[model samples]
Target chain A: MEEVKAKMPRYYLAWAKDDAIRKKGANGGFVTATLVSALETDFIDVALVVKKKSVYEGIPVLTNDPEEIKECSGSLHCVPLNLTKYVVEYAAKKRIGLPTKPCDARGIIEQAKRRQVSLENVYMVGLNCGATLHPLRMREIAAYYGLDPDSVVREEIKEGKIFLVSDEEGKEKEKWMKIDELEEKGYGRRDACKSCVTKIPTMADLACGNWGSNDEKKTFVEVLTDKGETLFKNAVDSGYVAIEEAPGKGIETRQRIDAGMQKRAASWKEKMDALKALSRSERFEFYVGALKNCIHCGACKEVCPVCACEEDAKCTGLYDERDSYAISMYNLVRIFHLMDSCIHCGQCEDVCPVDIPLTLIQRRFSERMQRHLGYTPGMDVTKKPPLYETELGWSAEAE
Target chain B: MAEEEWEPKILAFCCNWCSYAGADAAGLERRQVPPTIRVIRVMCSGRIDPAFVLMGLLEGADAVLVTGCHIGDCHYVNANYKTRNRYEFLKEFVDELGLEPERLWLSWISASEGSLFAEMVREVTEKIKKIGPSPLRREWKK
Candidate 1:
């Protein structure tokens, strides 16, 4: 485990062997097929999937049936649910499999570190992500372009553009808008996704996406860990999937795309930071102005994926609504607790009733502290968070 | 027409075995201690959670001081090491919250270090005085 294998990363051009699933699933149905196969073979007792309800909405479904897994094919870019808590609360004891975005996988790993869930019983199939759109923003974009939001049939983000296909009178019309252009008008991806640098779920057992695939029907996959290998080997053995060694060009292309996305994310981090231009006193005013509107609703804490403290949360217990400080004890305690483990999932901002730009606020406090500790949270389970360590693991403390 | 001069309220969290005794020692030695400080004593520095510091700030304390036994000298084994670890988080947090970096402090003061305790208090008072009132402070006149 210590030695980084020069060729240890196993790459494959993977596709669902079943014709029906391949047609229904975007790219290949490898994730769906793998989950189905795992369940069929009793490799996992259950699977968690976000069953799409509409183009802009989906509901998380926990099931042990292979048929249900097949129906849950395709990705929902706007379904920003974190599957970690679902696994912890519902499937913590059972061997289970689930597809995950980078942030979801990161949250799960963090939960494992906190002993909230046992990783041995969980199998994560990671997807390479380019940011997800906020559902409310989708409606705004629909209205801006003069289309009925409910009539939209399919939405896909590809080649720096968002494609919304609408069905009217048995005919489909498509409209394309560049993500950058939409974001400039304040109507694209969420602020958290824009600033996020970890686009690939490296912490997951296996990572899969369409970035480097030469064929539109195939997925490029990298098996990251032993559990990932078990899932891959099971699917191939069960004849549920087909795999070929990924071409060198495909691997190079994947790296190139990932690097370009990270570069864009860096600029977005600068552009979207509300605190960047403010003077220290101005920054003070900004926080007070934003956080004071809080009605003491615990929605932000409730939606936080990395937070393991549920009913007995210290933030809620210590909070008194009457304490009329510049910032509330609720906000203060929550921010402090999340300083080390916030994955910047943006769920808190999405759920806030007062619409506090909490994505930016939490990021402002956490980014500096994480960098100073030279520690990145949610990447590995064996390494404890620096906040919990007795002495920080700094290379040159004197320096 | 002068209202009472606004004095900085500094909240100091002292560990019972060490820094609290150090404060008592300061009194016994007749060292000049600042009246601005209000000390809250805990059993050990390890018991001081990051929430406590944030709570102090939210309550309108101009500054909060985290005082503990020196690194290797925890009354409970290896607890002050935990305190030092958490101090790193509080330092960054106070700075990022747009508070002056001088608003939060961590110093290791043993029971014997009466003079150092007195000096740290004086230094904190002067720094807070320059920074003026905490923005969180409520003013009924306003």
Candidate 2:
């Protein structure tokens, strides 16, 4: 145990000291406690937390008050908002601490690379995620389970089962269903979450979750960087949290879980790619057919996490409504620009008004290009995107 | 009109420092170059943005050529290398978009290589003719 604690990147089982917070939080209250402690100590100027309006809704709230942070405890699995743009627009200059999922952390990292946000001012507490359900889908799921969607007050996922609790006429009822069985019936996670392989937020400062912890009231925490160590020390010294070294068996279990999730995600990706069977001309027809429905709303660009260009973007600037080409210049330029840097977050598809399946189209174009260049965006701050590289740094023969 | 009599309209972007002067030399030498190509001269090959090429294809050009100085011979001290780097991205994009690979061409020509300029135009014209008109072309209503 001492040897494990002595390592640079340490692992531990941690929980909150306060019983109220522990009871309210989904996994222990370690994340909530740490953020509260950081704010109380003035370590961060503000903390960005997801405030749950209900089981189906969460809004990003930026605050310095520790009381508000405590109130925002617990997890909301149906909220799929990416908080990168909010950080850039609202708290880019402040010392901000926030709990991040893998996609949110990756988006922030990519923004840092583009000079949109300073990495030094941001502290991330990462959460391990298997998947998130769309809010509408969750409602449909409630209906399918023979419960009034509005009556459902609580939801929990554990042991490969989805548990829903409903209140009616001063009585409580509970029901559970297997996630695999639900997904097979065409109703589980969002399309993006089903294929995403990054189940753990390894790119963030500290990663916290319940994957490896033996107790339901404790969180398995991994201090991934120097900043993570600082956050952990502050939480422990402030007396808001308690910790114990993670058992070796717990570490093995965590690794096994991550590997299993990644394997399942890869298989899902293969199954979801419908364009793989099409010929060149048919693929062209499919793209034109899908993209023609775009109303030029630009919602996808607004929600895109990797795109740093705010106004006066080339895609919109060069596109003219009069052209009426087979494929609009807007879609063409946007796809071309993101070839090297797209993180495939699926935020675009979520916001697209026409339901054009932008996620599948962007993935088809960008994934092959990224693989050819041997580049993965948002992974590192120093490795510049290959698209911006000069010929001297990037050889033409590399193709 | 017969298929053999159909002429493909080609758009060629020539850099002022090298390829543009090479085209001038071809005219001076009275070389038998194809009249199918329409020349658009820019200050440097690096100035030719990928957007320009994409716009050309969307505008119904049967083929587009990107002509620049040879490697290490760029008049702007490696700007043409940037053009080469961008060309790779354009190549992959065009191919994936279901366009024939033959529709796009990239070549290096010096000011003295007038014969090379004429030969490239003839070869490009021949290939475009064989492939027929691009599907992106907009036919005017009678």
- Each candidate: what lDDT? 0.88, 0.89
lDDT tens digits, residue span B1-142, model 1: 7798779999999999999999999999999998999999999999999998888887778999999888779999999888888888888787787888888888889999999899999999999999898877776784
- Spell out the clash pairs found in candidate 2: none
Q: Once superposed on the true structure, which residue ranges of model 1 sit more than 4 Å away at CA? A: A1-9, A394-399, B1-3
For model 1 the local lDDT of residue A233 reads: 90
Give the alpha carbon lDDT tens digit for every residue of A94-188 in model 2.
99999999899989998998899998999999999888888888989989998888888998888778899888776888989898899999998
Among all windows of ten consecutive residues in candidate 2 chain B, which has the lowest summed lDDT? B1-10
Candidate closest to the true structure, highest lDDT: 2
The DockQ figures for the candidates are 0.60, 0.52
Candidate 2 CAPRI-style tier:
medium
Measured over the true interface residues after superposition, the C-alpha RMSD of each candidate is 3.1, 2.8
Error of 1 at A44 (Å): 0.5
Worst 10 residues of 2 chain A by lDDT: A390-399
